[model samples]
Target: MQYNANSPAEYIRQVPAERKPAMEKLRERIKKNLPSGFEETMSYGMIGYVVPHSIFPSGYHCDPKLPLPFMSIASQKNFIAVYHMGIYTMPALMDWFVNEYRAHYKAKLDMGKSCMRFKKPGDIPYDLIGDLASKISVQEWIDFYQNSIKR
Candidate 1:
């Protein structure tokens, strides 16, 4: 679950063998679909996609030294998790994902405030995850975070 790796590739390497493909595919989907300007890094012990200081120098309000995190994927004890800040702060995006998930998968959605959990790696919805990754741009995220979440 927790890997002491310095890069996304290393993190993937440390994940369970059974989960390697899913994790890699998930990472690929996020990377291919996420808008430009979000850099990939390891944040909060997971493979993170962030708005770098070059784009928003203030960085994360909680820790200005670090880039503002937008999304991350981790292999948890029981599941593979996706943490997306947009769905936590944007009601419409949350609603859209919740609705779209039902149309994509038969099993009930397993999720938390910002974490989407998939107990079975094979069931992960790569396309929907890609769509979610593309929904918010870096500037849009910063604007919303400043006005709403950072307040």
Candidate 2:
């Protein structure tokens, strides 16, 4: 009952049947909005879409290979999580994101430093979440790459 962990099929296999559809839907949503150059892969035993160093490479900061946070999607035992470093690092967006969740979602959305966990798809704040995903325009990501290349 285990999967390869290196393949999306393997990752999808472990998700319970009931959660599969929701997980797939989330995957599609994430893919749709992700800025180009972000790689879709499995990480930490869950379906994680990462902006590999290629997009925001190391040395963007002090180290040439410093680890950067990512926006991730994960399926857990009781809920699915939408994770974005932006939630914490981008102060301008966090409060508005939280308020939108409160206004649009009927269920309580639990938050962490970088993630939002929803018990069901219905609980997901889709519009706001999509806006958050799209808020950072592709140009911003490209700019990060260009800047990183210089470092």
Best by TM-score: 1
> Which residue pairs clash in candidate 2?
58-64, 59-64
Q: Write the per-residue lDDT of candidate 1 for residues 30-148, one digit (tens) a residue.
A: 99999999999999999999999999999898999999999999999999999999999899999999999998799889999999999999889999999999999998999999998
TM-score of each model, paired residue for residue: 0.98, 0.76
Candidate 2: Cα lDDT at 71: 67
Residue-wise lDDT of candidate 2 within 1-151, one digit each (tens)? 2345787767776788887787777777777876665677765566665556665554235355533435667777678888886676666778889887777767777999888888876667655766777766544654654565577
Give the C-alpha lDDT of model 2.
Answer: 0.68
User: What lDDT is reached at residue 88 by model 1?
Assistant: 90
Worst 10 residues of 1 by lDDT: 142-151
Clashing residue pairs found in predicted model 1? none
Q: Best candidate per lDDT, number?
A: 1
* Model 1, position 30: C-alpha lDDT score: 96
Q: CA lDDT of each candidate?
A: 0.95, 0.68
